[model samples]
Structures are given as C-alpha cells and as structure tokens.
Target chain A: MAETGQILNLRRYRQLRNAVVVWLTLVVLGAFLLRIPRIHILEHTARNLYFHVPMWFTLMAAALVSAYHSLRYLQSGDPIRDLRAREAARVGIFFGLLGLATGIVWARFTWYLGTSLWWNFDPKQSFVVIQLLIYGAYFVLRSAVEDPEKRGRVAAVYNLFAVVTMPFLLYVLPRQMESLHPGAEGSPAFSDITHPIMRLVFYPAVIGFIGLFWVLYTQRVRLALLEQRVEMLQATMLEAKS
Target chain B: MKTWLRGFWAIFEKDIKLELRARYAINMLLLFALGALVVMAFAVGPTPLSARVQAALLWTVLLFAAAVGLGRAFISEEERGTILLLQLNLRPGAVYAGKLLVNFVLLLALNIVAVGAFAVLLRVQVAWPGLLALTLLLGSVGLAGATTLLSALIARAAGGRGALLPVLLFPVLVPLLLSAVEATRSALLVAEGWATAADELLTLTGFGGAVITAAVLLFDYIWLD
Candidate 1:
C-alpha cells in the first residue's frame, strides 16, 4: 500500500476517474434523451447506435493499446510493459463481452422479437464470439505457464498473433458472409443510412467509453503493481528471518 | 545462401525422418481423421448434409487434425530436451522454417486422407474437383504454418498438455476456413460461375501468403526466447 502510494500518482488518477464519471453520465443522458430520426424498424432503439456501436470502437481501441504494449514488451523486455498489455487485454475482453450482450439484446428486441429467438448467429455476432475465444486462449495460455518471465515473453508473442488476426476475423471474414449485420456491399449500408443527427451522440459516446476503458485499465495497473510490491516485501522478510 | 538452404534442408529432412520413424503424429492424425469421419457419418447417417454443412464439417475436422498433429513439433523436441541442442546447432530462423515446412507438408497430406475419406463415407460429390483440391492445398499451408509457430509458443510454456492450441488456432484460421468452406461449397455445387469462385480462391491464396509471411517474420523472436 505504501509502495502504491509512492508509485502511483493518486491526484491524476482521481482527476481522470472524476472526469470519466462526468463524461459517461452525460453520454447516458444524451443516449436516452436525444432525438434520433426514426427508421422503419429501429424505432426508438435506433438510440442503440450511441451505446452498442461504441462498445466495439472501444474494444478496437483497447486492442490497439494492448498490441502496442506487447510490442514494447518484446522490444525492451520490460515487465511493466507486459503488465500494461495484460491489463489492456483483460479490460478489452470485458468490453467485448458487454458489446456482445448488448448486441444480443438489441437484436432480440428488434429482429427476432416475433420469433422468440435470442441468438441467431448473425455473421458479425458469430465472428465476435470467435474473436473472444481467441482472447480467452491468451488467458488460458498465461495460466499454463509457471514462470513469470517466460509467461510474459510467450504471452506477449502470442498476444501479437492474436492482434494480427483481429481485423481478418472481425471485419474481412464477416463481411464476406451473408448476414443480417451491417456493411454488405450490395445492400443499402448501415453507415450510409444512419441519420447525421445521431452522429452528435455517437461520436461523444465513443470518446467517453474509451475514456472509461482508460480509467479502468489504469486502476488495474495500479492494483497489479501493489500486488507485486507485496510479494517483494514478503520475499525480503523471509530472507531476513532466514 | 547455400549454407542457409543446406541448414534448412537438413533440419526439414531430419524432422520428416524422425516423424516417419516414430509414426506418432501421422498415425494419431490419420486415426483421428478416420474416427471423426465415421462418427460424423454415424451421427448424421448417409443423409447427405447440405453442401455448406458438409464443407463446414470437413474444415472443422481438418482444423482439429492439424491441432492434434502440428502441436507436437516443438513439444517433442522439448520433451526430449533436444530443442536446446537444435537451437545451438541451427539458426532460429532456419529451425522455424524447417518446422513450418514439416508441418505444412504433413498437414497437407493428412487433409488429403481426411477429405478423401469424407467424400467416400458421406457419398459426397463435387462438381469441380480441381478447385476443391486447390482450396485444400492452400488452406492446409495457411493452417500448418500458423499452427507450427503457435506450437512452439505453447510447447515452450505448458509442455503441450492443454487445449490452448485449438482455441488459439481456430480463431486465427477463421478467415482461411471461411474462404475454404465457401469455395468448397461452390466446387461441390453444379454451378459453373468460374469468375465468382475466383474471390474465394484469391482470398485463400492471400490469406495463406499472409500467414506464412507473418510466421517467417516473427518466428525468430519466439524461437530464440
């Protein structure tokens, strides 16, 4: 705890946390209150653009941050970089799950409402699950290793492979398949049809959620550092006694 | 340049000879493939599933077979404690190339047995055998190269006692698998749209190249460490 006090800048963390709280509050309010031009089927749920889509954008940002840290870890062999990479992925997977859950609910109420269907294996939705499975493998890979240094190096390398597969899995493959999700070349695209009026909330929602990711990621990093310090102290105390 | 090629050839030949002598990977993979084929047939019965489902099943079995076989490349070396010896003898890059080549060739051959058995047991028929063959060839290369590198990563960690390989390999191979399944379906259909099949074929080729390129570029770091 004392080591955390020395290592972490409490004032900056507090300020960032406060700002994220305020920003997300505004986002939630705007998401519900703001007027969106109603499309035929989407109706009021068109407001989901503000929340559901940003979850993916935040996920992508988190992936980029995780990959960046993994690259740095490989370059410098820095344990701190590995910590940042792991924390980013952990938070990223959290956002991915939320995105998937929200998407399921949104699609249920909208597309499959009449049929009582909850999960339809839409191309994008199915692909997202595979993407999550890849990240889950990273966690499994980490757990199977006993040494911290070997775990970090191997995990970081595997993390790089995970990131390289992201675009092909999520975007390229999904778009190639027939699906109810957006962005087929022959159809009237979702991005094309979205009301410019919704962009007002949509852009801010993306930024706010990403800020929220940053705050959560920073918190995890601090906690991990504290745990490392505690372990070090325990080792020193045992040495002293011996 | 001659020495590099010589080193790669020596490692590759050594791997093949060792694998052939032991017959560990090939026997298990062939048995697994036959077992999966028989089970799928028994479960679904000779009902002749839709072309898409059939293609999906074929690719799924192929992926699993690769997972079971390719994962042993590094694991065996480590278990015998010969990985360190090999590392000291050959360059990391050469060792990587050798392992990948061995995996790619073995997987390609294994897929042949799987697909042949699949066609025979299920009474499956394809309109374009050439294209289907091409698809299987390209897809196997992509799958093998990627899995070989991942095998090294996992072997170095857990000593090869986990489901990490399949879980990791599946998602990475999704793009390739998608293209393969689509192309296979088209080949099995009576349709003659040559130009349309080009997209799937091109995607498979592009994906295979990309995976191999990435493996070549990154294997050194994974190998040396």
Candidate 2:
C-alpha cells in the first residue's frame, strides 16, 4: 500500500508538472501580447507571429517526430514505437490544419481583402494542403486494415515515403513557383531588416510551441498505451476463465 | 548489377508484351487523349490560339492522359494477382525500374500524339523542336516517376486503387506541369534561345531526380509489406 501510494504520487507529480508548464506558457503569452505593439513594423502582422508561425514550427516538429518514431519502429518492430508514430502523425495533422486555417485568415487580412485578390494559388498553400491530404490518406489506410502487424508495417512504410516529399513540397516547389509566403530568398526573416529584438521573442515562440506539442504528443501516447494494456489484460482474463 | 538489369529487362518485356497483346492501356489513353482534346477544342472554341491557351491545353491533355494511363498500369497486376508473384521474383529496384520504363515509354508516345494534336487543333507552332523535345523528355520523366510512386501507394488501399492515385498525384505534379507548360509555351513562341525555359527545365529535372531517388530507396520497404 505504501509503494502504491508512492507510484500514485509520482503520477500526480507528472500531472502537476504539465499544468505548471501550461500556466507558464499562458503567462509568457501575455507578456508577448504586451510587447507586440511596440515592435513598430510588426504592429499589424504581430498577431500572426503568435499564431501562424508557431503552428508551422509545431507542425514541422511533429512531422519530424513522426518520422523518427517511424524509423525506430521499422528497426525495432516495437508496437510502442508504432503507437508513438501514430500519435505524432495525429498531432502533426492537427497542427497542419491549424496552420492552414491561420494562414488563410492572415492572407484574408493582408492580401485577399486588403489587396483585393481573392485567391492567389500560392505554392506554399497548395503544397501544405497536399501534405495534409497525404497524411489523411495515411489514417484512412490505417483504419481500413484489420491486421495489426500489417497496419503498422504499411503505415511506417507510407510514412517514410511521405516524409521524403516534405523537402520538395515545402522548400523546392515553393521557391520554384516564386511564392509570396515570405522568407524564400529576400524575405524580412532572412534580411538585415529582421531586427535583433524580433529574434529574441521569435525563438522563444518556437520553443514554447514545440514544448506544447511534446506535451500533447506524450499524453496521447500514454492514453494509447493504456488502452492497449487494458485490452491485453482483458484478453488474458478471458483466456484464464475459459 | 547484371542480374538486376536482367530482372528489370524481363519485367519490362513482360509488361510491354502484355500491354501490346491487350492494347487496353494505350487504347484507353489514346481515346481519353482524343476526347480531352475535343473537349478542350469546344472549351477554347477557336480562341485564336494565344500562347497561354495553347500551353494550357497541351498540358491539360498530357496530364489527363498520363493520369488515365497510370491508373491502368497496376490494374492488370492487381486483377491477376501477379503483383505478388512478381514481387517474389524481382528485387524492388528492378520492379521500380521496369514499371518506370514502361510508363515512360507510354507517356512519351502519348505526349507525341497529344502534342501533334495540339499543333493541328490549337494551331500552336513549335519553333525549336530540339528544345521542345528536351522539355518533353524531362517533364515526362517527372510524370512517370510521380505516377509510378503514387500508383504503388494507392494500390493497397480499399477503393484507392482507382481514385486516390489522381488525388495524391495531381498536387505534387503541379510543379512539373507548370514547368512543362511554360517551357513548351516559350518554345512555341520562338523565345530567342533555351535561356528562357532553362530555369523551368532545370527545376523539373531536379525534382524528377529527387523523386526517383526517393522512390527507388523507399520502394523496397513499401513493397516488403
């Protein structure tokens, strides 16, 4: 009973740790909000800095995590790694959709309504949508397969292939199309105009979003593993009773 | 290396012979190409063959024709359950090369036919045959690589063996399509030299090489399952 209580305390400590992280994030975000207006050139676009760019960073981190887990799964044949891969993919897709939505909103404010162009067919937008569809197909493929091993193998293989397209779709295709997404060649991010002060906050924003993604991904993997454990335990109980 | 090439040639010959015997894939592709051209004619309707319209029509026909042709490439294998048999016999590299070769040849033929039809129907003049031929070669390689990879990906999914191929393929193929259209357009307009279309052609070749390398590396893993 004492040992059980200690294990319970450890779990509670982890939960508290997560809550503390969330609280700290909220406080930092509040500070970021206060700092945005003073940045002069970034006044109107400042709102996008908090939402759009962080989501893109988070999406990339999630995708890379998914790829890492996929490679590990292929090497080890471990179901836990497969679960991690699936969870990362699911989180990656969520952030991907968020990035698209936020981008459209930003575009509406900056380009569509303001510049009077309803649709530009920007290469970044198109490629991101394609990335979403490919992963969406990944999930559909997963659900369609009944055999667990085959599902894992197939999903891992597909994930490997799909990730290879990322560099082309994200970087090469957009640059070749001469996109307006900023930071391709002469965007402010790469230029001297990127104030030293802006990098200070931007770096933290990236780190904070990645941390948030990690929290969500770890929680999801735990839930999945717990569910699998319950299923296995129930099967064992049934076998013994039989 | 010799064994791999032999396996590749064997599979290539088998697909070619099978395709030749039935003529289903080519026939359907040709019919589809002609029908698309007719539809395009009606759509563009004697619009004086402006450079933009001519380029757009040529690419549309080629894109749709390749889509149709690629969709059928794996259908026979799936139907006859020969994909498994072939997979057991040949290395994944050989399978990829053989399939790509067949698709490349078919796309080359289809491009020729589509380009000829566009020249006649759309009244688009080809100024530099050599530059245009180079563009077609690079563009077709990209198309073949992308389509082959996508067809393999979609082959295993339920009902995906048909519709999902185009859905996954079209978005990625945009760069190639854009480059091909621009290069062909510049060539038609008698742009001073290859300099105008060089950037687009280089982009296509770079993308194609990357995709082919990736497909070759990943195909074995994908096939193992």
Give the candidate number with the greatest DockQ. 1
Scored by lDDT, model 1 comes in at 0.83
Score each candidate by Cα lDDT. Answer: 0.83, 0.76
What value does the lDDT take at residue B137 in candidate 2? Answer: 93
Q: lDDT at B109 for candidate 1?
A: 77
Candidate 1 Cα outliers beyond 4 Å, as residue runs? A1-7, A37-41, A179-183, A186-192, A195-197
lDDT of 1 by residue, B1-225 (tens): 677788899989999999889998888888998898889889998575888899999988898888877788888888788888887878877888888888888887787899889998888888888888888888887888789889988888777875788877887788888888888888888865345578887777777777777777667777786
Error (Å) of candidate 2 at residue B153 is 3.5
- Least accurate 10 contiguous residues by lDDT in model 2 chain A: A1-10
Q: What is the C-alpha lDDT profile of model 2 across B1-225, one tens digit per residue?
A: 998999999989999999999998888888889889978888877779777668877887888788767776666677778888878888989988999999999988888888788788877778888888998999899889988876775565443456556656665676677777778878888654498888878877887897798789767765666
Summarize candidate 1's per-residue lDDT along A1-242 as a digit string, tens digits: 24345448888889988998999999899889978877777899888778888888888888889889988988988788889999999998999999999999999989887998998767777776876787788888888989888888888888887666656665455546566666655567776877776877788899999999999998999889889989999999999999
Judged by DockQ cut-offs, the docking class of candidate 1 is: medium
| lDDT of model 2, residue B168 | 61
